[model samples]
Target: FRQIVVEFLRPPTHSDEQIRSMKAKANFPTDIGRRLRFENAFCRAWDLNLPPQQQHDVRQHILSYMLVFTTASRMRGIHPDGAPGLFDHTYEDNQVVWKPAPEDAAGMPAQAYGMQNGSADRAMGCLLV
Candidate 1:
Protein backbone atom coordinates (compact mmCIF):
# COMPACT_ATOMS: atom_id res chain seq x y z
CA PHE A 1 0.00 0.00 0.00
CA ARG A 2 2.80 2.39 0.84
CA GLN A 3 4.47 1.37 -2.37
CA ILE A 4 1.41 2.27 -4.38
CA VAL A 5 1.33 5.82 -2.95
CA VAL A 6 5.09 6.34 -3.23
CA GLU A 7 5.05 4.94 -6.74
CA PHE A 8 2.41 7.22 -8.18
CA LEU A 9 2.23 10.70 -6.70
CA ARG A 10 4.89 13.37 -6.60
CA PRO A 11 6.03 14.65 -3.26
CA PRO A 12 2.92 15.91 -1.52
CA THR A 13 2.03 19.26 -3.03
CA HIS A 14 1.45 20.31 0.59
CA SER A 15 4.59 20.97 2.52
CA ASP A 16 4.66 19.88 6.14
CA GLU A 17 4.09 23.58 6.86
CA GLN A 18 1.14 23.85 4.50
CA ILE A 19 -0.30 20.76 6.07
CA ARG A 20 0.33 22.40 9.40
CA SER A 21 -1.62 25.46 8.39
CA MET A 22 -4.53 23.27 7.44
CA LYS A 23 -4.49 21.87 10.92
CA ALA A 24 -4.23 25.31 12.49
CA LYS A 25 -7.33 26.63 10.81
CA ALA A 26 -9.34 26.60 13.97
CA ASN A 27 -11.82 29.26 14.92
CA PHE A 28 -15.46 28.72 15.78
CA PRO A 29 -16.86 27.40 12.52
CA THR A 30 -13.89 25.20 11.52
CA ASP A 31 -12.51 22.50 13.79
CA ILE A 32 -10.29 20.53 11.44
CA GLY A 33 -6.99 21.45 12.99
CA ARG A 34 -7.76 20.01 16.38
CA ARG A 35 -9.41 16.92 14.96
CA LEU A 36 -6.60 16.04 12.53
CA ARG A 37 -4.18 15.69 15.41
CA PHE A 38 -5.77 12.84 17.36
CA GLU A 39 -7.21 11.22 14.29
CA ASN A 40 -3.62 10.53 13.32
CA ALA A 41 -2.89 9.00 16.69
CA PHE A 42 -5.68 6.47 16.37
CA CYS A 43 -4.64 5.56 12.84
CA ARG A 44 -1.53 3.80 14.12
CA ALA A 45 -2.80 2.84 17.54
CA TRP A 46 -5.77 0.71 18.50
CA ASP A 47 -9.38 1.83 18.11
CA LEU A 48 -9.20 4.19 21.02
CA ASN A 49 -11.83 6.88 20.86
CA LEU A 50 -10.77 10.40 21.69
CA PRO A 51 -11.63 11.46 25.24
CA PRO A 52 -15.00 13.17 25.62
CA GLN A 53 -13.71 16.71 26.09
CA GLN A 54 -11.22 16.19 23.31
CA GLN A 55 -13.82 14.55 21.13
CA HIS A 56 -16.35 17.24 21.92
CA ASP A 57 -14.00 20.03 21.04
CA VAL A 58 -15.78 21.46 18.04
CA ARG A 59 -12.46 21.87 16.32
CA GLN A 60 -11.39 18.28 16.84
CA HIS A 61 -14.61 16.49 16.05
CA ILE A 62 -15.08 18.08 12.65
CA LEU A 63 -11.47 17.85 11.56
CA SER A 64 -11.28 14.25 12.73
CA TYR A 65 -13.70 13.29 10.02
CA MET A 66 -11.78 15.38 7.53
CA LEU A 67 -8.59 13.70 8.59
CA VAL A 68 -10.14 10.32 8.02
CA PHE A 69 -11.46 11.28 4.62
CA THR A 70 -8.19 12.83 3.50
CA THR A 71 -6.16 9.87 4.69
CA ALA A 72 -8.53 7.35 3.16
CA SER A 73 -8.42 9.19 -0.16
CA ARG A 74 -4.89 7.90 -0.68
CA MET A 75 -5.72 4.21 -0.55
CA ARG A 76 -6.42 2.32 -3.78
CA GLY A 77 -9.49 0.58 -2.46
CA ILE A 78 -11.36 3.77 -1.53
CA HIS A 79 -14.19 4.82 -3.79
CA PRO A 80 -14.55 8.35 -5.15
CA ASP A 81 -17.50 8.83 -2.82
CA GLY A 82 -15.10 8.45 0.12
CA ALA A 83 -16.43 4.95 0.80
CA PRO A 84 -14.06 2.08 1.48
CA GLY A 85 -14.19 -0.22 -1.50
CA LEU A 86 -13.45 -3.28 0.61
CA PHE A 87 -14.50 -2.10 4.06
CA ASP A 88 -17.89 -1.57 5.62
CA HIS A 89 -19.31 1.58 7.28
CA THR A 90 -17.34 3.71 4.86
CA TYR A 91 -20.24 6.13 4.58
CA GLU A 92 -23.01 7.25 6.87
CA ASP A 93 -26.55 8.64 6.81
CA ASN A 94 -25.68 12.27 6.09
CA GLN A 95 -22.17 12.08 4.76
CA VAL A 96 -21.78 14.35 1.81
CA VAL A 97 -20.44 12.47 -1.21
CA TRP A 98 -18.02 13.93 -3.69
CA LYS A 99 -16.95 11.14 -6.00
CA PRO A 100 -15.53 11.38 -9.47
CA ALA A 101 -16.59 9.15 -12.30
CA PRO A 102 -14.31 7.41 -14.78
CA GLU A 103 -12.68 9.62 -17.33
CA ASP A 104 -12.80 9.35 -21.09
CA ALA A 105 -9.86 9.19 -23.45
CA ALA A 106 -10.12 12.95 -23.58
CA GLY A 107 -8.97 13.06 -19.99
CA MET A 108 -12.22 14.28 -18.49
CA PRO A 109 -14.64 12.71 -16.08
CA ALA A 110 -17.79 11.46 -17.73
CA GLN A 111 -20.76 13.71 -17.15
CA ALA A 112 -23.80 12.53 -15.29
CA TYR A 113 -27.28 13.63 -16.29
CA GLY A 114 -28.83 13.69 -12.87
CA MET A 115 -30.09 15.98 -10.14
CA GLN A 116 -26.85 15.81 -8.18
CA ASN A 117 -23.66 15.68 -10.19
CA GLY A 118 -20.01 15.20 -9.25
CA SER A 119 -17.84 18.26 -9.09
CA ALA A 120 -14.18 19.18 -9.40
CA ASP A 121 -14.75 20.65 -5.95
CA ARG A 122 -14.01 17.23 -4.44
CA ALA A 123 -10.30 17.95 -4.63
CA MET A 124 -10.50 20.87 -2.19
CA GLY A 125 -13.72 20.05 -0.41
CA CYS A 126 -11.89 18.88 2.66
CA LEU A 127 -10.70 22.41 3.31
CA LEU A 128 -14.17 23.81 3.72
CA VAL A 129 -15.28 20.92 5.89
Candidate 2:
Protein backbone atom coordinates (compact mmCIF):
# COMPACT_ATOMS: atom_id res chain seq x y z
CA PHE A 1 0.00 0.00 0.00
CA ARG A 2 1.09 3.56 -0.52
CA GLN A 3 2.35 5.43 2.53
CA ILE A 4 -0.70 7.66 2.43
CA VAL A 5 -2.96 4.68 2.17
CA VAL A 6 -1.10 3.00 5.01
CA GLU A 7 -1.47 6.09 7.12
CA PHE A 8 -5.15 6.22 6.27
CA LEU A 9 -5.50 2.66 7.49
CA ARG A 10 -4.16 3.68 10.87
CA PRO A 11 -6.94 3.69 13.46
CA PRO A 12 -7.48 6.70 15.64
CA THR A 13 -6.33 6.51 19.24
CA HIS A 14 -9.45 8.29 20.43
CA SER A 15 -12.89 7.32 21.70
CA ASP A 16 -15.38 5.52 19.47
CA GLU A 17 -17.29 8.76 19.04
CA GLN A 18 -14.18 10.49 17.86
CA ILE A 19 -13.37 7.55 15.68
CA ARG A 20 -16.87 7.61 14.23
CA SER A 21 -16.57 11.27 13.38
CA MET A 22 -13.21 10.74 11.78
CA LYS A 23 -14.56 7.80 9.84
CA ALA A 24 -17.52 9.82 8.67
CA LYS A 25 -15.29 12.66 7.61
CA ALA A 26 -13.17 10.18 5.72
CA ASN A 27 -16.30 8.52 4.29
CA PHE A 28 -15.73 5.32 6.26
CA PRO A 29 -18.40 3.55 8.29
CA THR A 30 -17.00 4.57 11.67
CA ASP A 31 -15.97 0.98 12.36
CA ILE A 32 -13.86 0.92 9.18
CA GLY A 33 -16.67 -0.26 6.82
CA ARG A 34 -14.48 -3.22 5.85
CA ARG A 35 -11.28 -1.28 5.33
CA LEU A 36 -8.09 -2.63 6.91
CA ARG A 37 -7.06 -1.12 10.23
CA PHE A 38 -3.50 -1.08 11.52
CA GLU A 39 -4.56 -2.27 14.94
CA ASN A 40 -6.29 -5.30 13.53
CA ALA A 41 -3.13 -6.22 11.64
CA PHE A 42 -1.06 -5.71 14.73
CA CYS A 43 -3.18 -8.25 16.61
CA ARG A 44 -2.74 -10.95 13.97
CA ALA A 45 0.98 -10.22 13.95
CA TRP A 46 0.90 -10.67 17.68
CA ASP A 47 -0.95 -13.97 17.34
CA LEU A 48 1.95 -15.90 15.89
CA ASN A 49 4.41 -14.86 18.61
CA LEU A 50 6.97 -15.44 15.89
CA PRO A 51 9.85 -13.10 15.15
CA PRO A 52 9.16 -10.13 12.90
CA GLN A 53 10.88 -11.59 9.84
CA GLN A 54 8.68 -14.69 9.90
CA GLN A 55 5.58 -12.57 10.29
CA HIS A 56 6.20 -11.04 6.84
CA ASP A 57 5.25 -14.21 4.95
CA VAL A 58 2.21 -14.75 7.18
CA ARG A 59 -0.22 -13.29 4.64
CA GLN A 60 1.45 -9.89 4.68
CA HIS A 61 -0.29 -9.53 8.05
CA ILE A 62 -1.49 -6.01 7.38
CA LEU A 63 -3.82 -6.83 4.47
CA SER A 64 -5.22 -10.08 5.82
CA TYR A 65 -6.00 -8.85 9.32
CA MET A 66 -8.88 -6.58 8.45
CA LEU A 67 -10.08 -8.92 5.72
CA VAL A 68 -10.18 -11.69 8.29
CA PHE A 69 -12.00 -9.51 10.80
CA THR A 70 -14.58 -8.42 8.23
CA THR A 71 -15.19 -12.04 7.35
CA ALA A 72 -15.66 -12.93 11.02
CA SER A 73 -18.15 -10.14 11.61
CA ARG A 74 -20.33 -11.28 8.71
CA MET A 75 -20.09 -14.99 9.43
CA ARG A 76 -22.48 -17.16 11.46
CA GLY A 77 -22.09 -20.57 13.12
CA ILE A 78 -19.08 -22.37 14.57
CA HIS A 79 -15.71 -21.07 13.35
CA PRO A 80 -12.63 -23.24 13.30
CA ASP A 81 -9.41 -22.77 15.26
CA GLY A 82 -7.06 -22.29 12.31
CA ALA A 83 -8.30 -19.83 9.67
CA PRO A 84 -5.67 -18.23 7.42
CA GLY A 85 -4.09 -21.16 5.77
CA LEU A 86 -2.48 -20.65 2.35
CA PHE A 87 -4.67 -23.42 0.97
CA ASP A 88 -8.46 -23.60 0.78
CA HIS A 89 -8.88 -26.73 2.90
CA THR A 90 -6.99 -28.72 5.48
CA TYR A 91 -7.05 -32.31 4.40
CA GLU A 92 -6.81 -35.20 6.80
CA ASP A 93 -7.21 -38.80 5.77
CA ASN A 94 -8.84 -37.68 2.52
CA GLN A 95 -11.34 -35.72 4.61
CA VAL A 96 -11.61 -31.99 4.95
CA VAL A 97 -11.07 -31.83 8.69
CA TRP A 98 -10.34 -28.12 8.86
CA LYS A 99 -10.24 -25.08 6.64
CA PRO A 100 -9.17 -21.52 7.18
CA ALA A 101 -10.98 -19.99 10.17
CA PRO A 102 -9.80 -16.40 9.64
CA GLU A 103 -13.29 -15.34 10.69
CA ASP A 104 -12.61 -16.10 14.37
CA ALA A 105 -9.61 -13.79 14.38
CA ALA A 106 -9.49 -10.96 16.96
CA GLY A 107 -9.12 -7.55 15.45
CA MET A 108 -7.05 -5.69 18.03
CA PRO A 109 -6.49 -1.99 18.33
CA ALA A 110 -3.25 -0.33 17.21
CA GLN A 111 -1.44 -0.60 20.47
CA ALA A 112 1.98 -2.15 20.80
CA TYR A 113 1.85 -4.13 24.01
CA GLY A 114 4.85 -3.28 26.12
CA MET A 115 6.49 -5.31 28.80
CA GLN A 116 7.49 -3.07 31.68
CA ASN A 117 10.49 -5.20 32.48
CA GLY A 118 11.20 -8.74 31.43
CA SER A 119 14.10 -10.93 30.33
CA ALA A 120 14.41 -11.21 26.57
CA ASP A 121 15.31 -14.83 27.22
CA ARG A 122 11.91 -15.46 28.64
CA ALA A 123 8.98 -16.32 26.36
CA MET A 124 5.78 -14.52 27.31
CA GLY A 125 2.75 -12.61 26.07
CA CYS A 126 1.28 -14.16 22.90
CA LEU A 127 3.30 -17.27 23.67
CA LEU A 128 0.45 -17.95 26.08
CA VAL A 129 -2.18 -15.88 24.25
> Per-residue lDDT tens digits of candidate 2, residues 7-118?
2356533455643444343321122122222344223222222222122121211122222111111111111222333222111221211122232122322111111112
| lDDT to native, each model | 0.25, 0.23
lDDT of 2 at 110: 19
**What TM-score goes with each of the models?**
0.23, 0.17
TM-score of 2: 0.17
Tens-digit lDDT string for candidate 1 (76-101): 12232334333223322223443332
Cα deviation of 13 in candidate 1 (Å)?
A: 2.6
Model 2 Cα displacement at 3 (Å)?
33
Clashes of each: 4, 3
Candidate 1 Cα RMSD (Å): 14.9
lDDT of 2 at 111: 14
Against the hidden true structure, what lDDT does model 2 obtain? 0.23
User: In model 2, what are the clashing residue pairs, if there are any?
Assistant: 83-100, 83-101, 83-102
